[model samples]
Target chain A: MTRNTRLLMSMIFWAFIIYLFLPLIMMVMMGFKDSEFIGFPIRSWTFKWYQVAINDMEVLGIFAYSMTIAISTTILSLIIGTWAAMALGPTKFRGKFILFALACLPAVIPGIISAISLRIYAQSLDITPGMWAIILGHTVHNVPFVTLVGIARLNSQPESHIDAALDLGADNVIAFMRITLPFLVPSLIGAGIFCMLTSFDDFVRSFFLGGYEPTLPVYIFSQLRTGMSPEINAISAIILLITAALGLSAERLMRRNKKKV
Target chain B: MQTNDSTVRLQNISKKFGSVVAVEDFDIFIEPGQFVTLLGPSGCGKSTTLRILGGFIEPTEGEVFLGDDKVTKIPPNRRNVNMVFQDYALFPHMTVSENIAFGLEMKGQNKAQIKKRIDELLEFMQLDGFGDRKPDELSGGQRQRVALARALAPDPKVLLLDEPLGALDAKLRKQVQIELKTIQQQTGKTFVFVTHDQEEALTMSDRILVMNEGRLEQDGSPKDLYYHPETTFVAGFIGETNMLSCSVKKIDDDYVVLDWQGNELRGVCRSGTAKEGQDVSAAIRPESISCSAKKPGNKGVMKAKIIHRVFKGSFTSLSLEVDGVKDCILNATLAGALAEQLGDEEVWISLDPDYLSVLLR
Candidate 1:
């Protein structure tokens, strides 16, 4: 490559990175600004917004609600997704490709479309659109992610281990518990974190399906309509920190599991 | 421990997958405390037969018996048989000790007894002091030993090994073969080992069942299969041999005269029903033929030119081209000293009547 091409490539790469992170960096910076209004030129440093954001009872309650939904979604998705993965992971049967495609439909379709369809379905069924409805929607959306992870892990695992377990006087359930489940731990941890993050950060789905009680993302969207404040920036920074921590821990767990294998 | 009553019998078993017949009319009765090997080439149904005996797969027809009990419909976990898979299949998540103790734990053995049994097996398999390590931390041979130890912990009635040393290097494989034989003898348990390697089978098994094309070709002691093969397949598969297509010219009381490429060769009539003017195949082991530079006063000696001589350490293999035999190449393994002196020279090859194996085509 010539000097011009190398320079152009590096410039484009940095430009892409800056484009992705510029808003996040600005939000974090404004969280420390003393001014009530979020503006560019000059801001005195203050931690008052952080203090106010942490102390707001309504924001804390909404955060708790999001956590509850995310936790429930993670558990439900993990259970159903693991069963689906085990059924589809290792064997060939008729219509397997179609079944797999249908399983992954929620992930492939746009989130807003699924959210609107789910709301309509819930209304037709005469179900109240509230926390339970949102939880159901999130579970359906995240099952594919968990299922894909489980399938990948199962594909790498040898079937001989289960056979050996069975040949050693362990029945099917014992073999599964002793060999298959332990082998799937790393993928389970990674997929659980992924499901939790997906639920916590989801906006459009919650906006459509959530009833009187608002989730953290919906609450933040409402707050933005009122006005862009430093308090919102403070909360976003905290969420980013939590997400980074979770991502790092997931990476560490996977690396450690790989070394063990 | 119950070696005396652990006779396994596969009664006319046949298994088919889809339309492909994996095993057909496979029948074998393993005596108590015998070390039997299922030996064949790849895709020859040896592994399938072993799996069927282990209750991993149900045979499409026929019954399986352990001693007097029929176990045709039994699941693998319910049968008193264990297998060492070709890949070892050691549990990666568990430590070596944990893996070996798994079966005993499932049997509801007390903790102390399980611990004691594991220690004994670890020592017996020569894997002492490595119990705390995971399988990934061990070498290939070590992992195999661990797999064997795990299978032996519960003391199953019969242990099946499916090419367990297939993953090891050549040197390690030879060492494991000896160790495995010694272990089988010491345990006095019925062991049914499967391998595609003919030499491994000959070295380790008390009796070998050779299969080809989903059918049992021959089953006997290794020496019986090698020297007195019942079919042409067994004669060629067990060892290096020269096969001469011939027709019986005359059958004497104890000897048969074979007409081969316009040359008359006399061989001992081992086949009881040899008839005159019948086509047959004459098999001669390479080691049995003696090569000499000077013509010997032997009745069955033939003059041949040395086409190629491969200098193996213990013996030199000479490929001979005879004047009368134009269609077949005769191979003979001579002593290294004699082979060195007879380079590219015309020599007389003598086939003793006792070493010749005659098979009906």
Candidate 2:
């Protein structure tokens, strides 16, 4: 309300912003430091760590492995979560709230708890700690975000569009495919990227159910156990760049979709 | 037996949501090329009945017939009916041309046929050169016409419109109502329109079915419903009314004498149950009440004080208080300028006996 309070608020907000970005800035700066150890007085700067991160075959393989798992998790979660969302969207059934709660319960539980339960469940089903197991765990965690975003988008859709499609002689499947799915594409893409990015960087579940070959996050954790190096910082900075790009595109698309709708 | 020449037949339709009845025992047979309106207030089962006809809603108990075939169990896609939703319901993803082509494509029409029909409809709805535009690109009225074009593209047996003009401004709504009626007649398609607006129903529909509380109150022509409503709900819901609660003093062959606040007023016996000493309401329209400064010589006349005068452009509505009655306010709508004529505080009121129909419950 007053000038002093406004000044204080501005000071606090800038401090919080700096507090959040300072570590990331430091980590990215440390990647360019020309020392074996990552104390960041960069007496010399070189692109050699970035070159190593790009050229190392093992790191390349793990990055690709993480990408493949994220893609699979995104696909599976989109299908299952969109189904859950549609189920929760238009129906007036008695158990609809219960169904929605169950669909979103995984997102509320601790990631460690979800990982341990998934590991135990996989073991009970005679499944091995492999890529399939890791993908399954990631999908379970990612689906709730898809479902939440999908339901919200679906709610914004007019119920009459589907009805008009039906009145125009489209069957249920055709109506959904033509009218509802196209309407949901923006949210689906946004939610899909969200799912993929979360799955890619996830460590707890991947650590529990990962195969002999490590995903990038699991491999990074392994590298941390061995030692701290600028190589790891370079890999993380690259991953951050990719995530930023994807997140920005997703946000832009959702904003554009909002304007269109 | 299925009736001949009837385009739609809703047989003993009843819909219940859990324990609440939405439409009860509603039966109507619509002839071909007729513009019928299910007219009522909101939540009064008009939309529910229309949805039943379009097969969007399944009545808990009913059999629907389109022409000679029964379509009660059929879905909306299989039924030979199309609906223009209240919100226009145009697909936001599709262009106008694509939206119009959707129904035709579903009918398995060839590409050429679909294109030809789309052009024809765009022209018919006066939306030429606007086919490629998306719904958001168009104005409210243009979007409504586009919705009409899309619904008409399929050439269904019956076209259902659920308050499609409700979203437009008042002037646009009147323009669209006339355009829609003209389009229906030109195409000779059966139109089952639904609206809570009585004026719209009167202006467009050949037949209006007035519903109240899940029951059909009255079904007749616009003039018939306006002049000769069978129930009080129809009278009050259709237009402004001066419901003079009176008792039947005497009933003759052609006229019934109702004693209204100690005044004997003659009115047409609408429902034929005007017995002696029975309570009834004289449903009098304000336009039917003639007002003059000089006392009228009519037998059932009222000398009233002018309470309030609201001057409309075409006519003036004056609220009058009857002498010797504490709260008996009678409204009179007189044509032309009456400000110069009625300079006195006291006014004479005379009811047109023909328009003053006695409604008996």
Candidate 3:
């Protein structure tokens, strides 16, 4: 790349980094503000909001609800998505292209469409739009992301290694567990973290299907309507910190795996 | 019948992938403790047959025997065979020691025994002090040695190698091929090696199974295949040959009258059938054809013009244009007598019928 192009790209990259991290940084700063209103450029610092966030029963309930849904969505997405990817990735089958295309379509489509369509479908089945419905919506959205991660991982694996493993004296199941699964661990972990983070931070899908129990995103949305509070800022700060940690660890795990390869 | 101490038997084995037949009616007998190579061009059934023995694929129609047991239905891991893959196929994530210990681990051997065998194999393969490194961390030759150590670490009844040296460069390939043979001999394990390179096959194998188009063209010792190829494919594949399309005129007990390019002459028949007026193809190796500047009238001399000479280190190969066979070119290697240039000069060619392998279809 030319120097001009490199300079332009570097500027754009840092600009995007600033744009993504600025809001979280501001929210964290606002969480420490002593003033009643959680705003930018705080006049002083205090720990009252952090204290309130830890003790508030309603906020704790919302956090617990989101955590439960995110975990469930992550686990379910990984199980079904990994199964789908392995079925379609390595082996040859009729209509394989069509099956793969359909499997990947949900992640690209807008979440509102999936959530609203799932809400209608669930209502028709006489299912109350609750934790289950929200989970279903998040799973529908997360499956494609998980499947893509899984397929890429599986594709990167040289099929010869598995064949060689089998030739060496491993049965089908044993070969898969010994050779294939160990290689896939990094991608599976990465996909699981992504699924959980998406489900946790999700607002549209949770807002559409979450009926009785409010997810943290929907709770944050409700808190937004009541004007910003330092407790909300403190909670956002905690959620951001947790997601950032997951993102970093997942990235590090995949990088370590790549280094081995 | 266990007639020849055959450790592995493939009977009329055939494999098809959709419309393409990868291996067809391939029959091979691998003797116990023998180093046999399946030599062929790519797309031939050598590797496929190896896979069948490794139990990686089920033949479309055939049976495979390991000792007295039929292993056609057995899965690869369940079979008593191990393979050193073309790319080595060492697990990237595992250290060299761990990679070698994999098969033993599958056998449920305890850590102490696995470690002991791993060390022994590493030492035997000359890979000591390198167990902690992963496959990527090692050089190509090191990786190859590690792969061999891993395959041998399991103490398999049969060791199958599919183009084991194909990934290495020329120098490393020769060194490793000798190492592989020595290891096989020391271990006294049955080795079924596959390679497309005929020279390597000739050097390494006790018996070479030459294949073409998914068919076993010929199976014999390197000397036997080199001197007595059974088919046109084997003659052209296993060694260099100058094929001349000739027709038989009369067959006798000792020799036969052959019509080559409208020139009637006498040639020896090595084996099989030859009838009067039967069309046949004959092969002569370059070294078999004796070239002379002056015409020798009496024996088996055919007229030829010297087209060009290529000096190949120890020998010079002369490309000659024969009379009445416009497109037919004969390659003759000349030593002391006919080594000098006889520019565009017509020379007499004498081919001993005893040395010529007549391939009859």
Instruction: Say which candidate scores most in DockQ.
Output: 1
Candidate 3 residue-wise lDDT at B50: 94
Task: Give all TM-scores, in the order shown.
Answer: 0.96, 0.94, 0.87
lDDT of 3: 0.85
- The sequence of per-residue lDDT tens digits that candidate 1 reaches over residues B74-107 is 9998889999999999998999999999999889
Q: What level of docking quality does candidate 3 show?
A: medium
Q: How good is the docking of model 2, by CAPRI class?
A: high
Residue B82, candidate 1: how far off, in angstroms? Answer: 0.4
RMSD of each: 2.1, 2.3, 3.7
On DockQ, who's better, 1 or 3? 1
| Docking category of candidate 1 | high
Of the true interface contacts, what fraction does each candidate have? 0.84, 0.95, 0.70
Every candidate's lDDT:
0.90, 0.90, 0.85
Report the C-alpha displacement of residue B179, candidate 1, in angstroms: 0.2
Interface RMSD of each: 0.6, 0.5, 1.3
Q: Candidate 1: where are CA atoms >4 Å away?
A: A124-126, A251-261, B1-4, B268-272, B340-344
Q: Comparing chain B with the reference, what is the TM-score for each candidate?
A: 0.95, 0.95, 0.92
**Each candidate's DockQ:** 0.87, 0.86, 0.64
Indicate the residue-level lDDT of B344 in model 1: 75
